[model samples]
Target chain A: MKAKPKQSRYLTLVLILGLIAACTPPAEKTAEPTSIVEADPLPSWNDGPRKEAIISFVEDVTDSASPNFIPVADRIATFDNDGTLWSEQPIYFQFFFALDRVKALAAEHPEWKNKQPYKAVLENDMPTLMQQGEHGLLEIVMSTHAGNTTDEFDSLVRSWIDTAQHPVKKRRYTELVFQPMLELLDFLRANDFKTFIVSGGGIEFMRPWVEGVYGIPKDQVVGSSIQTEYDYNNGKPIIKRLAKIDLIDDKEGKPIGINRYIGRKPVFAAGNSDGDLQMLRWTDANPLMSFQLYIHHTDSLREWAYDRDSHIGKFDIGLDEAIEKGWTVIDMQTDWKIIYPFEKNQ
Target chain B: MKAKPKQSRYLTLVLILGLIAACTPPAEKTAEPTSIVEADPLPSWNDGPRKEAIISFVEDVTDSASPNFIPVADRIATFDNDGTLWSEQPIYFQFFFALDRVKALAAEHPEWKNKQPYKAVLENDMPTLMQQGEHGLLEIVMSTHAGNTTDEFDSLVRSWIDTAQHPVKKRRYTELVFQPMLELLDFLRANDFKTFIVSGGGIEFMRPWVEGVYGIPKDQVVGSSIQTEYDYNNGKPIIKRLAKIDLIDDKEGKPIGINRYIGRKPVFAAGNSDGDLQMLRWTDANPLMSFQLYIHHTDSLREWAYDRDSHIGKFDIGLDEAIEKGWTVIDMQTDWKIIYPFEKNQ
Candidate 1:
């Protein structure tokens, strides 16, 4: 689907990781459960309104005596996967998966070394790739993401996520997640709030490994998608992925995706960019007492910090709105004692 | 979207009720718990292979020592709506909803009495209404179902469902759901199987009350949809419903819907028509020890029974496939002690 120019490149990014370790998925969803004793739900935080806001909101909503008390089933919390829950510096992670796939399959498609977008990807030229815009990105993504059975694609993501290293940070992409956010996810789940990931990344790409990394399950994660076909090859049944786009799941799409997938309005929402504006606003507009937070990536040393003029995960207009609404804007350098999960070990 | 002519009229129905009360939805989801003790997981099911097959399959898959043992997270079970879980005789309940909405809105649009499809509806003319074909039905459905805020549509359905009576059955549409299936849903939940409704009905239509009616939460429901927009209505954010079609979720679309929403193939699937053949085949195709069932509507005296030639939920090809695959064909009259929950009152 060729989207309107304004709804262009940003629409199709689909990120799908959850909890890192809940349901034993504490790796996020299934691998290693992030260990937390009952004493402190969020230990990584330095302690302030940024941290207190999360605790106070949870306490008020879960407290039956409070006027803000929301029932367990109605207590839905949505978070943007990229930047908000983890890092999306330099560029989005799924884009890396696309570029890596192009390079991996370069040997198969000999002509790709000469092709425009394919050439840009093969040479690891970010500047050239940026010029291709949404069209180029879609071409690269569809070539690698589509054209396989769902099970085959699942294994592809699983293998890649296990060994793939972040280009700049030189850390496993999963380990780059904010420790405070992970604790927040666990804290919310502990309070009977059903947490979900609403992203602009591929739904399939995220489902493969999010559980072990986020404790969020496959079903709880919603993201942008491509069309799929149910194929009956003689006797075997397989879902064949089609290159055609299904949902964009970005900007205004966040709330639309929530309605399609989650149904009820989320009382809690968190995001990091202009892309997340609609979701935060939607949460703020909920009839129930709601909480909205904007994660300000201000820690230039611990994490890449970019806003206003930055291209990837820009946080300009959303930041303005967060401040205007009196929503919590966490200044990362001042608020967090540490950033990544690996920092805790150090 | 003008669908392929073959995929026309049947593409837009969205039935959203589940375990009537599963989360307490045992009403299949919530109003009443149905008062079943742990002793009998399925009291409505008669003592036969149809019943025994369910017990054995569950025991095998849930048993840790059994070769068929599936991990708890992997225990997904999907079901078809309409005839499989509830009654779809005469026509789909959503069609009834469309008709009623048209009638309710008729006082505002006197021009409808003179219009073709709406005139056909106002006159209570089925054959004339059927003659309007898919385009006419879409016109009727879109007129009533679309153009409202999502919250408004939610309230509309809620108000209508509370008071509306089934034209023929005389009972409420929710009351027409199968007693045995409700028991089956509760049974599966007890054993750790995650049950879902994979229907061709409207996603929004089912979300509001399904948790109370089927015990399945709002997020668990997946069905056909139209486009919606996130409008900041003077800062009062609302998801505005659009008449544009989204997903059809029928036939081959069933497996596609399963992939899009649940992101996993079900180990058990049940249905009553050819529309569900792909889902049943998809479940049967699962690499696990899967179970497939076709509810053969065969008891006219107790419940309306029509099979191969029935217009609403024809069960010809699916029934033949079930028998050939050696899968269970639930003989409704013989296999069920009661067809509906109300029968228990008598």
Candidate 2:
């Protein structure tokens, strides 16, 4: 087999190529309905009062004959993006994007080398960045996100998402999304529910990848964003981005955002943190077959679990409220069949 | 013929009952789809670049096999709640709710009897109320919206919507929603598109009835809101509303609100007036299949037709930009199969 050095090297290359080709996932197939009733992802969910309550609500409301049957135009459901539909462990996904943006845009703005958050970001100094806190995060986001028009900003976001990878997980940021939650989104949409991602992240940050990752179109995603200014330059008009925080979209802001943006009260609401408490409360208060669910991160093996004290994606107050209010608290370790699509038990 | 008096009275009673029964819709069929479909609601739409573009985009994005195939989770589609989804011809729906709220709450707070906007609202003096401008509207909203938790405020709104009637339309505000737009929302949801209502209306004012009107749930609604305080009163913590304008969900505010609330850019957006232009602009900036539709009120018979100068839902700058930008401009009169779902149309 080792006839010559050159011959052996060529043989090794061929074998490596063959293995790589075999390991690659087959081209994605056309998703088709295999059966009308195939499988239930959350089979452990008991057919008790809570579960039946949802089913009966949907049935009675969706039924045209029932006085309670709501029109199809009104079957809206809203879910918080971070922690609710996707995992927000260690840090938020958007913050990672911000850090990457800071690094990418740093070379152009060498002044950022001395800046607080950017300096911290470029040096991979998490502790320093944390010290800078929300104001620092805002500065970093504004510096990296501003100066460009909305169009240019969107491109930057899209490019970064396409190339960025989570440092710890060594996976694309999109791959970090929870699989069971993804299935839940699909299930809701399949049942005529209009699902929305109401998050406190930058609006433009999620718009680029949400369609590809969450199946939610850009318009359906509501998030926090910076202020913008429209002006004329060289006889041409253009909109320029400004670093100022236009609105803060968290906590009580959720209900306000929902009211202004969606102009409706959701029949169903889901979140993983206290930031979404008001949204859940507002939804539950409605005189409809409404439901609210909270995601509890309790598993450390599959993912980090630090609920009582976490700088980002805190879940302490909301978790207690969920329990006290008899809300459906999804036990990440016990309930979820799979946490993420990319990971398999080692 | 001599027995005509008794016979006439009996016959009149039967006729009156028949008319009343006719006014009400046939008991909605329990098994029927929640809203109308297959009506080809927008028949005047040419099978040209504009119409086909949207249809093809939706079809391709929903195919699952296509490269543009969006996941069900990311199928969020945002809409402008005013003219785009319903009639904002002579007045905004919130204005109507405000007027009624002012009158209902007037006798209790007689000081409003001498107030500017409140007095105007109480006396049905819309002209004076309009003059109070956005400031007046905010005042009215705050006065009616304050002194209660979000839950209590929502109940008040619900009760008002359930009973209030539009002066000219003489129908519940819920019935004022455009039939075609309602179908569009349903169609999108059926195809896994999550629909939302983004508006300049007060958040608390709209959430109570939006689900009933637009099929958009409370949490899916985003709108302008005031600052609130959550406190424990009488051993029960309650979220009290305030008069301070925390945020305005219109124009530039739209994009920021979109960011803060939905966390993703919408693939599709439909709006009328300059308030929605930035939202449309933001949505169009997405890399994937995207669309921005403008509702041009061109039908005076079924609905009012005035662009560029209408005070209520003005469409001057937006109309020009839409045409130049190649956005879908729906000529409401010509394109619609029916303006509203009423006895005559149905």
Candidate 3:
């Protein structure tokens, strides 16, 4: 009796309700927005060395008469895309998305079960999964990312980001971006600074969402990328994506990429792990007045902390060196007022 | 008798009086006004086909709704330093500057006669000069450029440019710049384009006067350069120049330099020789709307007119190809209202 037309009608109603909710405006007001009234992400950042350092640097450098003053034209700032600007817990947000894509498309492609990386991803075996490391990750990306042009892949990523949720948090990864850092980016840009993202992530992967997430436009985002060839396919000129890595925009490669793309050394730099140490050092070595800040993940309950020896985002020697050089070190546990956006419920 | 100081002084005064009377403002405005009317350089350039083409392309790309519309942030335009925007005749301005430097400092450096390229330049021997070609040019640049830190070398170039005059035209090299191209540069920049000078000239030599001459700030000048090392000299860290050529920014090197430095294809390319051919081709290959224009030196009266076989600033194959491709070929004789600033004869 329940499996007849009544169930079909109920399904239709649910679909219409979901579409209506999607179209509805967010509850937050535009002028006096409720979102703006939320907890400050870095409330514990006292008006001491941490806060004063940034203000003094900005004021001094922006003052033309000051010996350390850098012209507004030369004020370039670079930020790491991963943990520095957004959350990278459990696994990097991209990895989680790739895993989900493999599962969702598995029914369409029955042979995925026999495939190596997709099979490993589908089974949800934790220890066995990561054993593939970068090689395994590259395989998953190539299998899913290829077979189409760059524009087609960008659409796929956009669709995934619109609906997919983080495994542990059950919230969109876009919501996991650090609100404090977003504010900082806006503040820097407001003061006539050109902010750029220099990341180890795939260039094509991050380019689609970077503008929306960080307010940094696509051209300003430099990252790892596979070699792409521009070709005419069926009278349409398309940039075809390849499976092999063309360049890795990480570590020493960071400085190379910065000099290659930016044509100027950044006066301000921020990062979260060892991968960013070279970029910080490069920024510090510039002739202009410079600032380098490293984010130290030290909170567990609030947002899960694992630094030092973490395989995914190691921050050991870099942390020690930052302290030695008197660089700004952001202690996540004590400095941040809030962690994830959902943590406000606590 | 003329060797006496008083006679030379009297002769100089007489010459000054004669020139002032001939070239100075009218009697009523001689001391009354004498205002330096900072000229627009190319005010008479009616919005013609070339101007319309450029404006339409930029407008379409910068407007978000248009299919070709790229963001203003992604609007990048690269211009060839010589011939495209300025005169490169009698000799490339940089080469002439190098020769003048060798001559002016010859009194102190008698040992230069014993050197290879210096000896070749001192004798004013054209055949031997052409024989050395690029290799000799590098030698001349290194001798004049190295042995000082970047700051000191920049000052040296600045001083030479400030006092020096072109041997043939008898005007300052900066005054020999094309008025029409200057307008084009400012026009592109006004529309939020990032314009760069991609040249074969020594980077250090171009940086000092480029800001004042072209209004292109130092950071935007990409050129051939010697290797530099960061060193602690006299308790201050500085980039010290060396004699070794790290990169040559010319011909095929031009495209490589653009790729290595800017990381994006130009939306608009303007050049004047075969050296710039590859750069224009590269820019023309952009999937987005693009424009390429070449300056053909066809006016013998207004400016030196020789192409196909001219030794300096040659325009053989590039001119033929530009005509074949139906690219806008700027006829300097007919298209321009003025050539060099001094060519006005005021």
Candidate 4:
């Protein structure tokens, strides 16, 4: 009772019923190739220079006869998740998740109502929360994200991802993912590229829903993780997620995370902020023909547009480097036909 | 120039030239799967109860209509490296690597000619080296394994693997990989299982050569690691491998490493020693159907056989658990037709 690939499943059914005529015609039907452009793979992307460059890079690496041909085994493409794949405007989506968690758990830990960061979160005071800064954010993240089995945390994230909506968008956080980026992921996979998410976000938080939303499987994700311990509770084993930080998986940590988890340099890497500069540099450093893409949020009317001046997902040095190096900078305003999938009809 | 999957390359060429005759037959020719066994995928495995069970497990998990059918993404299979996949006799093979490295490095560190561990390593003094114990081993391992950039370390391991031979076997260390295990890996992969090497060996040490020897990719390897630092050496970036221990990847740490790197519990896991107990337990704990395998070194004539009373690759607890749980146990002497690839002809 071996699991069959989709192609083989149909073939098995046809062959069992002695339907050779059924299989032959379908094979010939798919033979029409060069006469047509094989459907616009990146349909969400506008036919701009950035889109052209991205398609060209994929073609260069995949064409076996070309000088830039990369082996399929080495066709690793990494992406920064937050701003690169999904919206990180207002603040990182994970912060909202943490805030919501803090509110949910406030019932159990009533002291949160009086606590500085927790109190600020409860009152929905942004300035106060920002004043509390890194330590406060870590406190909220660790409190809600850890102190449970990985299974329990996965359940928590699944519940939140299923129910919670973006405060501004009035859509699920998963819905905030870029349609262009989703198309890009599909296009890369269609061409035999293994796409991975090397994110600064909590690995567990993304693992539960990434497969559904982005089509990136759990194991393919490389992200910031808390220290975990194997707790063999009388043979009912569980991996305990501790509050201690294990990996940051951002900036310099991105390359290190790639090395640790992937052990191969990505031929293509995409990012949005200065935090992604190191990863872009790392991908560009690959001996193979590599592509570095920077997504510039220039569409204020469609998606929030803030770059260098913004505190969250600040694009300063990486923007300068992308411009200087002539890397593909995705002008979200002009280059994207649509922002989120919800905007497709509009 | 996009990298072409072999299947598509031929199809594209035939369709472009309008050669319909060349393409039609290869499709239906492969349909006769039921009449014959698929080329005896595990050729090196003897036809015994262990082999039967292993094959049955694979068939059970892979059959699409079966209740036990695991989806391709969930079909993760992990193998312990040292004593399980290859031979780890007299001492762990990595120890041999470290000892040889110490001798090669002795001229640079002149004090090492008289040093306790280094002197012992240079003189081939096993009894004295054993006396220095874990602390001494760690010093040798760290000193030899770290301080270089990951690239440099990769080169060193590559060079060593290219030349190093097992003392007892007099064969290249890579050549000593179990023939049956290699076949098992291929069989699993052919069935769409993603195979990974989850070893206690150094991550860098395994990455450079495992792909060449075992057909397992570098990223798929989960192993013990030293802390790596991203050094942007005037824009010529390098990840410096430090002497600090980042992960142990043994015993309880095996499961922890699996969690960190894979982020999912494997449905299939194989091991030979007590150190792999936790990983096996964790895999068995998978909610989906799971298969745990223990490689019992019962072939004293062909390979060194020591299990319950052995110091290296001690198999007491794992053996008892395998027997008690009715899990698959590979008796090397009885179940394997050949030990290593070199022995295939013999």
- Count clashes in each candidate, considering only residues at least 3 apart in sequence or on different chains: 86, 61, 2, 12
- Writing each residue's lDDT as its tens digit, candidate 3 over A141-179 gives 667766667677788888888888865566788888876
Cα displacement (Å) at residue B10, model 2: 51
CAPRI quality of model 2: incorrect
With candidate 2 superimposed using the best TM-score fit, by how many Å does residue A247's alpha carbon deviate from the native?
4.8
What does candidate 3's lDDT look like per residue over B1-346, in tens digits? 0011221111122122112223312112111112233543235343467656666776787778998876665677888887777876655677666677778777888997877667766887555655664456556666777777776777778888888886656677788788778878887888788888888777678888887788886657777766555443443445567776555676656665665445567788889888787777777777777788888888666566767856453468889988888787887766666666443443
In every candidate, what fraction of the native interface contacts is reproduced? 0.81, 0.21, 0.06, 0.72
Model 2 misplaced stretches (Cα beyond 4 Å): A1-40, A43-90, A115-117, A124-137, A183-203, A214-224, A228-241, A246-302, A305-307, A310-339, A344-346, B1-93, B115-138, B145-149, B165-240, B246-346
Considering DockQ, which of the candidate structures 1 and 2 is the better prediction for this target? 1
Q: Tens digits of per-residue lDDT for model 4 on B30-87? A: 1111222467888778788888888899999899999999998899999999889998
- In order, what are the TM-scores of chain A for the candidates? 0.90, 0.81, 0.83, 0.87
Instruction: Candidate 3: give the clashing pairs.
Output: B61-B69, B61-B70
Q: What's the lDDT for all of these models?
A: 0.80, 0.66, 0.67, 0.79
Q: What is the TM-score of each candidate against the true structure?
A: 0.91, 0.66, 0.69, 0.88
Off by over 4 Å in 4: A1-38, B1-38
Candidate 4 local lDDT, A1-346, one digit each (tens): 0111221111121121122112111101111122213688887777878889999988887999999999988999999998889987556777667878889899999888899778977887665765774567667778988899988988988999999987666778888899889989999999999999988787888899999999998889998888887789998999898877777777778888999999988999999988788889988888889999999988777786768846453478999999999999999888887788776544
On lDDT, who's better, 1 or 2?
A: 1
Query: Over the stretch A1-346, how does candidate 2's per-residue lDDT look in tens digits?
Result: 0012221111122122112222323213222222223566333333355445455666677778988866666677888887777766445667666667777787799988898867877887655655774456557666777878766787888888888876556677787787767776786787788888888776777887888798876667777656666443443434567866554557766775565466556888988887788788878766666778888877666665657545453468888988998888877766654567654332
Model 3, DockQ value? 0.07
